[model samples]
Target: MQFLYGVQLLIMILMPLIQMVMKAIGIGFVSYLGSNLIIDQAMNYIVSQMSGAGAVVQQILGLAKIDVAINIYFSAITTRMVLSGLNKLQDRKRAQVWRAPGGTSIEA
Candidate 1:
């Protein structure tokens, strides 16, 4: 982490890998802050599409709840980013399992 914070060394060594980590970090922050309005809306739409999501959202939203408008703002941001992180983690795990006998794919 320290190595990447220095621009000169980062471009040569850590740039490629760091880009993804940076993106995940950004998405996480964006979803956390509810700053990414369109993304949050899209997430709500997707969740609503799911069969059990309506009831689940309702149940979760009902108890120990904050204000309606505030809840919408908070929920929109958090749910999407959390889902995105989970999806990425699942994909990474799948890739790990699919690797060849030697572990890594290339001669790095």
Candidate 2:
């Protein structure tokens, strides 16, 4: 029990650091993608090819003569990546708890 507590304490201490590193990586990735002209053009082409709400959004921005910054798209992608990472981390914790010795399995 003491060993388990120690491990838990260590994880608690490291979690924030892990999240901070992830955020930093996400920001760096977005910046890199935004700064590359080829990637930027590719992304614009992809967005323009998109249908439904994407089309409407593109039309709106075009009509308004607003050149949406690349950061807008990249920031959204970064946010999604971070959220997905957090969800996976939580899922792993839940799996550990559910699969621990003598722990009851949850059925869907």
Candidate 3:
């Protein structure tokens, strides 16, 4: 848990550090990344999955956008990772929560 906190903190701290570098480069790096082909592909994939959800949603609510869902998905996945990592990190709680501890360690 503490380790995951460290990682999340590291990510949050580094984002601005990196963004500062991009800003120094004279092109708003946010806009640069936003215009990337990979983003387009990811957004298309998410919207396609929403359409597959099959509920006539877009007709009734014309605002079912992929950007919102993608942000939600990112938060959900990141939270799941950090919490699950923390859950496994607690020595006393590990056996209760996970089938194995020292999961990547053979010395156990």
lDDT of each: 0.67, 0.71, 0.67
Top lDDT: which candidate number?
2
In model 2, how large is the Cα lDDT of residue 19?
Answer: 99
lDDT of 1 by residue, 1-108 (tens): 675568767586778789889998997787657656765676577556543557766676656363365558667666876788789888887744455656566644
Candidate 3, residues 18-96: lDDT per residue as tens digits?
A: 9888786655455346545555677678778767764676654447565576878766765775577567568555444
The regions of model 1 sitting more than 4 angstroms off are: 1-10, 35-88, 95-108
Models ranked on TM-score: 2, 3, 1
User: Whose TM-score is greatest here?
Assistant: 2
Cα miss at 31, model 3 (Å)? 27
How well does candidate 2 score on lDDT at residue 51?
Answer: 37
C-alpha lDDT of candidate 3 relative to the true structure: 0.67
User: Candidate 3: where are CA atoms >4 Å away?
Assistant: 1-62, 92-108
Give the range of the ten consecutive residues with the poorest summed lDDT in model 1: 62-71
Give the Å shift of residue 90 in candidate 1.
2.6
How close is every model to the real structure, measured as TM-score? 0.29, 0.35, 0.30
The runs of at least 3 residues in candidate 2 whose Cα sits more than 4 Å from the true structure, single-residue gaps closed, are 38-108
